[model samples]
Target: MLSQKAKYALQALLALAELDEGDSLMIGDIAEKQRLPKRFLEQILLDLKHQGVVQSWRGKNGGYALLKSADKITFGEIVRIIDGPLAPLPCLSRMAYRKCDDCVDEERCAVRRVFASVHDATTEILDSMTLTRALNGGEVRELLRGTG
Candidate 1:
């Protein structure tokens, strides 16, 4: 399951992708528009800024904006940043690997193989999707639910 932080991060990014021309947005504005809490939004944006996914501006007209093109940022990247890994289990994870302790036959684990396929499919979907694509794909509600 995607954490709230991950979902909020994506929502905020999609909101910015609507105007991905390197313009800043007040954190409060993104919160209200995306139906997220102000302080929480601020924290997520801060973390994203730290990751260099988004940049911040300071002053009367300051807030947040994508550091890179919205089309260049992948959902998988952000999800990895926020949720840690895309795989269902640590042993199945390619990016963040950790062998399971109790597994007797990791070499022939059918469940691990199944999860690997699922992870691969998920990776394919998210890697191909960018914030701009999600925003331009359809209405915000549909995009959030990932179906229209």
Candidate 2:
């Protein structure tokens, strides 16, 4: 499940992505436009800025904006930043993998095998999806329908 914080972060980023290049949006404006909590959005933006996903300006005309192009920012990156590893279990995690104490043979563990497949598929999809694709609602739907 995606955390509310991560979901909000993506929403905020998408909104910023819609703006012209080099344009910044104030937190109040973002919260009002996206129907998000202003205080919560401030924190999310701070975290994003710290991670280099966004850059902040501190002045009268300052706000938040993407540090990179929309296509360069993957959903996987945002999710991992806000929600930690995407793996269902620590044993299946690539970034934070830990062997189960009770599992003697990871190679033959049926649970691990099943979840590993699921994790691989999920990771591939999320990593491949960028904010640009997400913003293109019509094109994305058409592409998905065609793929299906």
Candidate 3:
């Protein structure tokens, strides 16, 4: 499940994605435009900025903007940034892998095997679904078809 913070972050990013090149939007404007809480958005933007996903400008016209092209940013990247690993189990996480306490043999664990497939499929679609593809409709469906 997507956390509220992650959802808001994506919404804010999408709002920024709509801007013309070299243009930026203030935090308040982004929050208002996306109907997000201003205070929470402030922190979210800061986190994103730290992750190099966005850059902040200072001054009268200063705001936030994507550090790279939208097509270079994937949902999986942003989600992992804001929400950590997407794996259903710690053992399945590549970045934060840990042995499950109850597991006797991971290779033979039925639950792990089933969820590994789920994790693989989920990550495949997410890693492929870039912000540009998301903004352009039908790309997700096409990605889904390709994955299957």
Best by TM-score: 3
Candidate 3 residue spans exceeding 4 A from truth? none
Better of 1 and 3 by TM-score: 3
Clashing pairs in 1: none
Pairs in steric clash, model 3: none
When summed lDDT is taken over every stretch of 10 residues in candidate 3, the lowest stretch is 139-148
Q: Give the TM-score ranking, best first.
A: 3, 2, 1
In the range 1-148, model 1's lDDT, one tens digit per residue, is: 9999999999999888877475788988999898999888888998999999998889997878889998899898999999898989899877778899888888799999998888877887787788777766734454446573
How well does candidate 2 score on lDDT at residue 105?
93
Best by lDDT: 3
Better of 2 and 3 by lDDT: 3
Candidate 1: RMSD over Cα atoms?
Answer: 4.1
Q: TM-scores of all models?
A: 0.89, 0.91, 0.95
Alpha-carbon deviation at 132 in model 3, angstroms: 0.8
Candidate 2 lDDT score relative to the true structure:
0.89
TM-score of 1: 0.89
Q: How do the residues 33-72 of candidate 3 rate in per-residue lDDT, one tens digit apiece?
A: 9999999999999999999999999999999999999988
